[model samples]
Target: MVAYHSSALDGVAANPALPTPLLLRLIAFDGGGHGPPFQALHRPGLPEPAVAAVLTHPVLNARVQFAMSGQADAEQRARLANDSSPRVRAAVAYGPEWTHDHRTKVRPLPDAVCARLLEDPEPSVRSALLDSRHLAPSFLASLVRHPDPAARHAALRVWDELTPDGRTALLDDADPEVRRSAALCACPHDARLTAALLRDSAALPEALSHGLLRRADAERFLAEGVHLVELAGNPSLPADLVDRLAVHPDDSVRLAVSLRPELTEARRAAIDFTVAPHAQEHVGWVAAGIADQGVLRRAATSTHPLLRRAAARSPHLPPDLLRHLAADTDVVVRTNLAVHHPDTPEEVLMSVYARLGGTFSAWMATGHPHFPREGLAARFADHPDGIYRQLAVRDPAAGPDLIERLSHDPDVWTRQAATRDPRLPLPRLLEALALPELASSAGANPALPAGEMAVVMDEAGVPA
Candidate 1:
């Protein structure tokens, strides 16, 4: 599978007719006063012409230059390291595609470039560097004592890599926040430190809740009558204390107790818990450990709805389980299966889209590979709801006239979808490029010929 993040301009970039020279021109198109420069420069393995154009195109603006820096070669990065623009330099510091978590195996910057960025005058550049996984161990150790408390906390992402002295420094740091972060990093391994963190009022709630609290410490927290809400959710809390909190006077405490993973449905029913319909918190069982197929199957068939919801999030579920959950009575179960499960049936995705048409999850559902698009024009061309009408453009059955007419649809989503559909005639497509609202989708429509795209670039004032 091609491991690339989808971009709005991907169809334009992927056009076979878009020659090297024209793609290079995209690096300097200046967006025709519409939006950011064409994102083709951010794709991997740019031909030498595109690389040279980015390096030597003095007229290229800062934002386009920043896009090139994401995929720059070591030599290109070395040049960008000294570029006058802080944003460009910041991009160099962060390595390739740092903003997106797609690429994991990134080559580190040259040692000199790393040294320069560490002391770079711009805080944004240094901040971007902290987020990059390409930073060397030595740089990470130095950042542990950085003047900025946030940097000190961020550096703890690689706590095991830090020197023993560096770890001790964070644990004993004067800043309570830094110490609290260190406690989170160290508590799982060090019981003594975990016990100490449980005493500090500032750290008590998080430490008691997240750390594996000792049995005695769990009892102590219960006896104190403080942080009961936090204690109720702690996995390490003694069974007796968990029972005691299930009936605690505080509603929040019982609510937390009711959601604990160890509690069976019968036990949870005994608690006076009022579930907020929209915001019921389920255990993130997938994150906790979801590899065992047996455990996943049990979760899928569990009597508790939350367990079924968690099971639906497992991407590796067998087709039988997916079918079972897709037909599950719970809306969240069906939606989660559609959004997260790779083999979710086409019918389930359309159902979720119908229920959550304008939501983020609905966007994800429509983007799924198996989403139904082939005959949608016949089904939704004149649906009363504009969201349903937008599906018409996705259907091959949608005629050029239908697409052009929908391009003028009052609903923005329908209009945008029509603008991207290749069936929309070229003249109307070019006209859509002038509308700031639709330029991005129009610019990406694959039907726009390579010659016309070059003309669009030239009109946008690309350098010769």
Candidate 2:
């Protein structure tokens, strides 16, 4: 079988004039956005005929069209805007589901689709319409007044897009959440509104910070124990108020101070200093923050492996402790040192690997932070122990060539492991399945083509 496109939408280009059976297979393929195969497709270009086939695909599955809407020209987007499946229309309204911050274009939806999806029955789909550029000021004005307060909460996401009038409508909303969200966007609120919002327990910190409430009001709320943690987080607090909270009885509140110079000895010994139940990760952080050599050394030698693992990762862990931890009996502690302890000497890392020669940790320490080079990955790939070789095969640094070699590993179990690696793209997966011993496991691999998975059994002459 030909390899499926990484993104299901690209399958339309497989044959712009696909037969019904093939078209059905393409449409039935996973969305490839987040599920099995875990791949995303990118087309060199979309030919018009292929898109027409995607729209006309007899099956009602519209997810392919949904994925393609992002790349469609204005006219094609308009046609997709009217697609019968609400799912397709929702996609048109939503535009591209993913965009990085540096990307210049915040993909805008068509006005028609944007207006409709604002009231889309699907809550999540409706929330997405908040990002569409085509949702103009006029539409947002009406949306802000919609009876549903939920619409107001959703509107806050795109608050930067709203017109002055639209912004005003939300600022004056009866709903405290709308007002709270508006304040979150840094909109100034009047005293009357602030007073009302301050009384709302749910609206505590946001409303108080922007509310311009009197110091008396703030002190009253603080005395009442309203939003102590939140008050601690408010960056805009008056300096006098900040000094008062710095010594507040709550240790957690004291921890919240971003510029807190140091912890008092009594505070350091508090129960909050270390998390309980075998993950003293917090203790590691506190000790590192203080750069206390005594604390780190004690934690490193502690009988508890979790504390040792935590201490191993500390920047202040001295070279002597790093050496001590490299040879630790606990597998987690030893691996933690290999993967995370930068201060450990190269000689120490090498010795750790020699002790646990077959492990990923052993292979990993050769270059330290840099992935194992070809020579090291190959050494593990060619290791006598199938498990270590399997680990090497699974490592991202081990490229396709290593995978091809392991696919024919004499042990059926090793070949089976080779078949299911999520990184083993579909073409490599199919090639691995050619080894009949891999057949049973290949069918179970999430990477197998959903519609054509039967091919694994068919070619291997094994039953599903």
Candidate 3:
């Protein structure tokens, strides 16, 4: 068996591709209250056999059912919504965001189940329902005036899209805190109200960060000097104000200005902004969502390195533009292309990893689906940097002896990576599992024989 390096070495329970029969056995094992044993059931496209095991297993724990709640089919979801355990019910109400593998996006529960959850007898379940992103507009409207202030606050997630009547109700809410939140939520869409709220010193910072700011207001804040950072980040700041802030004395403010999407390459380069070694707050490209071809084309060709980097982050960039960014002069741009672009070429990902392999963010490039494995061992096994040597274990062509040698390497990460390699001998793999530091990754190595897995499960008090 070969290691699937595309997935992280999280643990056995998190491995989405575990065989269906094994998954069924895991479902039958009671996890007590611990999470891992049952978590695998959350994987997308969970087999019908595994789902049946979770639902029918006589000894299945409530936590087991809780973990599978989100990915449950429509009929199963309805059953879970009325589950005997409140915790299980709450799990369904929360609407888990992603399937266990992080591949499939989980959809909202059926409308009927959502309606029942809205009025669930347990306040915990009801509270969980409010946190769900899938709630309908009408449900949110009903929640905005809920007697519980927390419920009303939770409903404000949809405040920007709330109906006029809903907004009015929240504006006049009995709770002063609720009223304050309502004002902030309405500020972007209600220019007159934003203008009025600007006069209040307490509301000024958040207002400048996201609320619409007129030229006069920006100038006044500039003179005041306290909110310059927020002013630079404000999407609605006027063009002239944006230009003025680009040259502002504060480095943070200038950095923020440099990231504004409206600035041309020349304007951005003139700012003398410093790109921090690590990422700071997300820039305009992130907020703008998926950009159009025209926007991406301009960003890719921009003289400003950060603009090119921003374009690299666009997953939908055309093939030519993707290649352009892959070969970009800036390492950051190329790295971003490797990490974010779905179609980044194999060579680009390898190059980025070879350069940044020791860096914390390098995993993103190495773990990319397109990363090459054919010659990795031969290329990096003798490299001076242990980080590069660590990658040799990922090479499918590497032999058992090489895997064993690396498993004993002095570099902790190298040892860890080697331990996860399926090529490691059975005795060595079991030895790695005995070591607390390496056990998790060792268990995650899909190469472990099924008979051995059953024995391991039995030792954990989970008999097949």
Candidate 4:
């Protein structure tokens, strides 16, 4: 038999003596001669039997009852605060909720209440007291050395509000993580402490970009290959260093340097043929290119090779101007006009292609989104380059013969691209699934029979 508190039935002389088991059953027993115990306990102005049952035998939790009961007022809260169970005391401490009118007038907890909890034997109760935003700064400063690291960590959040004397105490403390946390929020600008903090790997990234490390230290880390990828990605990385890394052997390193916020980064990522565009030159070019009545006037008169190239690459430059640029004395300017200007008219491109047929510029123009697909079928249908045939297979104009021809193209790329063709029938799709290399791509084609797809995946041990 389970024992229950007799306090549940106090102050009821009229209540009949009931068996302990029967009363225990009544606690959870909502159905009774007095209807449900729940309705009787909570509903006001109840009949005597229901009230008697509720007052005598309650199965409902005390916290829920306390939370719901209006009678748990200031006096009741104080009474519960002294209860032997720490749980009851903690619940009581959550209370005496301030009224809207008194919220601004009230502190988070009364000084006396805070004082009591500050000394609570239970860590949970004491930890709850740490949530007070309005706690005295001196109090938090003192807790910084609290025996419990959890409490100390909580106190660290208010480190900024602590007296400078208090902050000085923890800044050089033995714990590195605590020191790192301080460095992040403080931005103390102390070169020595910053260097020490950076020694901790956890703090290295922030330290590298804190913009306080000497240029030598930053460059030293860069040279030693320490955190190169992350260091390259740092926005605060010196421009000179970024320029140096643009040609690094590692593709990811160069890619990182290329993604910087401005045109410097763009130019870094570009094929910097022989001579590269300078930052100032790019700025001047953008200015003149966006200016009205000036690109023609400027390019005709300007002497800077990079500036001339930048002007040639502008989309707003007229077809007549693009044609003129195509014949420029500077080969680089002509190349930029041919390959980089997306808005250059098609007539200009065809003319450029005819003159510069074998150059990289012409090859790039051939695939430009605006390049007319007028003869893509004849030009690329059986082109030696697999990429070209892959493009041909995907072209909407590809006829059945070309699609079938590409389905067996020596290049797997062309074969994969053919799987998307609506004209490729179910038999060809089944053949595609039989090839392990093409099975995944072929499985995605709706034309493949569902049963065949299942069989192929099962044989291949593939999940649906």
Candidate 5:
């Protein structure tokens, strides 16, 4: 036997290749015999050629793989469809390069591959395929059947691309997201589909249901009409709704309707059932819109003060009615007529003033531009009532002579009113203030007698 001494070989070697025996021994040291093959293909400074050689090398090719998911270049991508490693095959399945047309190239991944990936112990890979825009429809359908809510949501997003029948099938989907998407994505123009959606109360979101019910164009559905009925049934329905129902033919239904602008004449006439003061007041107003002067005149005598007042204020009230209301026992009704009655005679107004003293006369005097100021002033001067005298003095229409005469009037309010007269001259103001009796009274009561003092002081060059 030849003795191969390692120390002798190291000394003798000078760029000599490894001996055949040594080479075999080194190759066998690697379990798979792949070490020498890989080293040969991965030599430094020759990257492209080395990689190509490794991909094709008989011994190393079993460990190498490429992604062939899909691409416009079908044949090139399909060449790696049978790649050994699952990672490389999954890369092919989700490769960005695989556009819609490239999907056909991936024809049939093995059942094992599909099932394993579908249940992919890894969620990320499964999710990518589930959400892929270019995913095959058949594959997506299969995925939707998986017991995953996320997969169903993803499938629903693309339901519109499916055939009409396919979309209809999703309406019964176990997942609400899928069902809702089906309802919303159904062709709005298709009345059948819209009706179907409307019928499935379970599948609708509250907002979407409301939107459909309120849709102006879908009037044929009578959805709004139904809602209006529901609103009528609501015990908390607005008073306006009851007012609307007041005229409804179905007395029962009418009770549900509130006050709306669309109330019919007959319906409005039916509101007479309401005897409450406020209800009567509103009815009187509504009646004024429809009733003649005769009817309003009758209402003006209504026991309810508000009804009487409304009748009195009616612009369409006849002259005869106004004359009747001018003598109303209710001061408010009388006052209303005094201020608003266009045809009320001057005599009737003056009579109202004389009978109903206080601010009633003042209100009439202020509002009626044609009120007889001289008559009122004379009445004030002669009348035993101090309030009448005060009202006459404050009349803007009162002449200066009447005011001057009233300036010396015995009543303090009468004199105060006279001083307030914008027409009262400076000399008269000073004279009224300087009188011993008037000056003493003016000093005693600051507010009542202060008016003449203000005028007199202002005329005397005193800062007002």
Candidate 6:
């Protein structure tokens, strides 16, 4: 008797071109290293063999079957489909010639083969089937019933093409992923299904529930007045859903109700009540659709600092409102007014500088594009804060005279700032440097000199 082992058969089965008859003979020989049990062997480079020889050799037959599957020959593929080994038969199942019609033509795969392969023993085979562009709906539906999450996931991925009954079967699927996928695919086609999914408090998992709520909210907010009114009239809407949507953090929702063409005055008031104060500005801006001073005034007076600041910077603020905010207590409001208020009077601007000190003064002293340079120069020169003096010295309006004046000011920061002033002439600058009391007072000290020091004058460019 031949004495080959299972391991030798595996080696031959793995080699596509290995002869099966020799492999079987080796298996019969208990894996002895000698040649085939049958001594008559075809050598290499032979022409096509008889069909009998090909069928008798398992390894050669598998190779022939694999080759026939690759060919356009349908008869050869059909003949190989009945091969005894599941491995060979499985190759035929995957072969290109095995169309949807061939599912029954091939030898019946074992239930375990279908079950084990439901997840696909091979990832390439599974993934190819999962992603098959041309898979028929009937074939896909059958695969969907396979007891594997992976196969179900694949079927759910293509669920859009399934019949209504097929899609309905997946609704109660054990896998939440499958249900969620179906929900997403179904939402666009069937409003009743979407509403049912959304309304089924327990049907949706938390993540999908939140996603659906947000999506529905967004869609409702964007819908026309007629549709929104229709949805609002639906008695089925949960009270919590209504309240949550009414007080929704989105400004657009409030604005939608506020500006709805069909809204009664009472409804408008209710929307105003539901919207947070901060969200009102968006409603007002959209309602006006143009710059309106009344809106600006209301926003400026709002208790919300953000609204107040926004109003202070609004292009829609009237000239009078700009004038009023020029002296606002909040430096940000005043600064925004200073920067944006085209009609801000020079006196109001000066008051803004005087009242809003530090960076605000510095901001004003650096000439605003619309403000007169002479007024800004005067403010910078006469600014009570010494920093503004430094600003003045740096100003183009500051000639040699102003530089001379600032260079000897008791405030060291002002003096130091003056020293770097581009407008300070070399003669006045040199004279200022010669004054020991002015230049020798630790010129680099960050602290400004106290107001009590002598004011050094150098009209003739004299060292003090």
Please tell me which predicted candidate would have the highest lDDT against the true structure. Answer: 1
Clashing pairs in 3: none
Error of 6 at 67 (Å): 64
Backbone clash count for every predicted candidate, in the order shown: 0, 1, 0, 0, 11, 16
Each prediction's TM-score versus the true structure? 0.76, 0.51, 0.76, 0.33, 0.31, 0.31
- Model 3's TM-score against the true structure: 0.76
Q: Model 5: per-residue lDDT, tens digit, 381-426?
A: 6667666776676455777787777777777767766754655656
RMSD of 4: 23.5
TM-score ranking, best first: 1, 3, 2, 4, 5, 6
For residues 1-464, could you state the per-residue lDDT of candidate 3 as single tens digits?
11221112235555444667766666666555342354465555667776666655554354435434566564555566776777777877876555432324465566667778877889989888877766666566667777878678766877767778878988889997787778898887667767777877778777778887777888888888877888888878888778788788889889888777777677777888777544534556643644688878877888766667777787889988887888776878888787777788997887788788877447777777888888989988888889789879888899999999998888888988888788899899888866777776777777776665655555565545
RMSD of each: 6.1, 11.0, 5.6, 23.5, 39.5, 30.7
Higher-TM-score candidate among 1 and 4? 1
So what's the TM-score on candidate 5? 0.31
Write model 6 residue lDDT over 1-464, tens digit each, in one string: 22432222232222224344432332223124332222112222211342334344445433334422322233343344445554544443454543222212333333333333335455554554454343444556665666666567667656767777767767667888777666756654555555556544554332222233444643554343323432332323344445444554555544443443233345445653333432323333423432666566655655444445667666567666676666666666666566555555565555555655465343653355444445445767777777556556545666767766787777776775665454566565445444554343222221212110112111211112
lDDT of 2 by residue, 1-464 (tens): 22322222222223223334433343344332221121112222345554565565444444434344444554465566556676666666666544321122444545565666666777666665675554555555557677778767667766767778877888878997787777656423355556666666777566664455556766776788867765654544566776677677786665454322233334333323222333433342434343578776766766545557666666566778877887787665665666665556655565566666655666556547433334546567777877556556646677666666776787665676666555556776665544445644554455556454434223322222
Q: What is the C-alpha lDDT profile of model 4 across 115-198, one tens digit per residue? A: 576678886666656653445455565667766555565557777687776566566545766656766545446666667766
Ten-residue stretch with the least lDDT total in model 3: 1-10
Report lDDT per candidate: 0.73, 0.55, 0.72, 0.53, 0.47, 0.46
Model 2 spans > 4 angstroms off: 1-48, 62-79, 91-112, 119-153, 160-164, 174-180, 183-193, 208-213, 259-376, 382-404, 408-431, 434-464
Ten residues in a row with the worst lDDT in model 2? 35-44
